[model samples]
Target: MIEILNPTLLARARETGALVADILDTLRSRCAAGTNLLDIDRWAKALIVEAGAVSCYVDYAPSFGRGPFGHYICTGVNDAVLHGRPYDYTLADGDLLTLDLAVSKDGVAADAAISFLVGDARDAESVALIETTERALAAGIAAARPGARVGDISHAIGTVLGEAGYAINTDFGGHGIGSTMHQDPHVPNAGRPGRGYTLRPGLLLALEPWVMADTAQLVTDADGWTLRSATGCRTAHSEHTIAITDDGAEILTLPRRAREL
Candidate 1:
């Protein structure tokens, strides 16, 4: 279901977006060597409850995943990329971690994800992977606007990742988000420009650019949720929820502190 949020709901979306971003920022700050993935999930749950927000993931039951995610946040480590279910694993120094979150406030929802190193980042490859995903996400946002097509955004993101020498995966990508977490039109990480749904004002899109260092193939972990790189290569993912407006795309999921600045 595609939704074009009205102004009132859009306002709520911004609020939810801020909450998601702030929680992510706080989690990132708390992450360090010896931090357990399950602990991160607990922290996220606490923050979400304190904010009086509803988790979009905890009770989520999608066909692609096992029923009821039962986790507040996704914790992807190193080779793990998408749908990373939080588990009992201690983060080591230089471990690449990706945290993906979504929440609803006042009946409106927002989603976002970030990838960073656990401690002092010594792996050049990990740093580069994270940077490339960030750049790709920016490129995708830049291509979003009223009258622009979804493919344009996908193409822009693809150009950045392709140039960075990372393999793109289309099975899971960005999508329309509003009252619910995931909606249509599916926004792939790579696609041809001038194709797909045309953008319009009031449309909310979650643009995510993710890549694997070596291959595009993915293998699901035993948990029946976490998706990892088929070749055991490290991966990185970056995402943000944007609202299409007359001027351009307004990023809704930027941290409150960042928005203040």
Candidate 2:
């Protein structure tokens, strides 16, 4: 459903967005080599409870996924990209990790994702992939404004990824978010400009730009949740929840520390 939130609801949205961003920042700082993915999930759960928020992942059963995500966060490492269910794996130095999180506070939902490398093991290719996704995310956010079509955002994201020489995957992408986690208006990583749903004030969109190093194809892991690159290439993802306003797009999911700066 396309929801144009009311003023009070929008305020609640801000709160939810802040929580999501704060939790992601904390997790990023805490994750390192020797850290178990399951520990990260547990840490996320504690943070969510401490904030009095609800997890959009646990008990989430969708047709595409094995019912009931049963976790607090998605942990995508190296080849894993989307819907990566937390497991027993411990992060290694230089491992590329992507953490995707969504939560609801005061009845409003916010979603965001970040990709980064672990420890001091920084592979140039991994760094490039992460940087590319971040740049693509910025481009997509720049294209989001009142009256702009969703295609415009898609095109902006596509242009960045395309120029970086990464193949685009359309199987899963960004979506609308409000009282619920995933909503209407699927924003692909690539699309034709001047087409698709037109943006409007008060509209909230979670625009994510993700890419695999070599191919656009994906393969589901035996765990029934992790989505990995079909060619076993490294991947990266970046995302944020944005609200269309009169001036432009306000990125609600930007970290509070960043906002303070």
Q: What value of lDDT does candidate 2 attain over all alpha carbons? A: 0.94
lDDT tens digits by residue: candidate 1, 28-53: 99999999999999999999999999
lDDT of each: 0.94, 0.94
In model 2, which runs have C-alpha deviations exceeding 4 angstroms?
none
Candidate 2 per-residue lDDT over residues 1-261, each given as its tens digit: 899988888888998998999999999999999999999999999999999999999999999998799999999999999999999999999999999999998889999999999999778899999999999999999999999999999999999999999989887999999999999999999999999999998899999999999999999998788899998999999999999888889899988999999
**How many clashes (backbone N, Cα, C below 3 Å) per candidate?**
0, 0
Q: Give RMSD to native, each candidate.
A: 0.7, 0.6
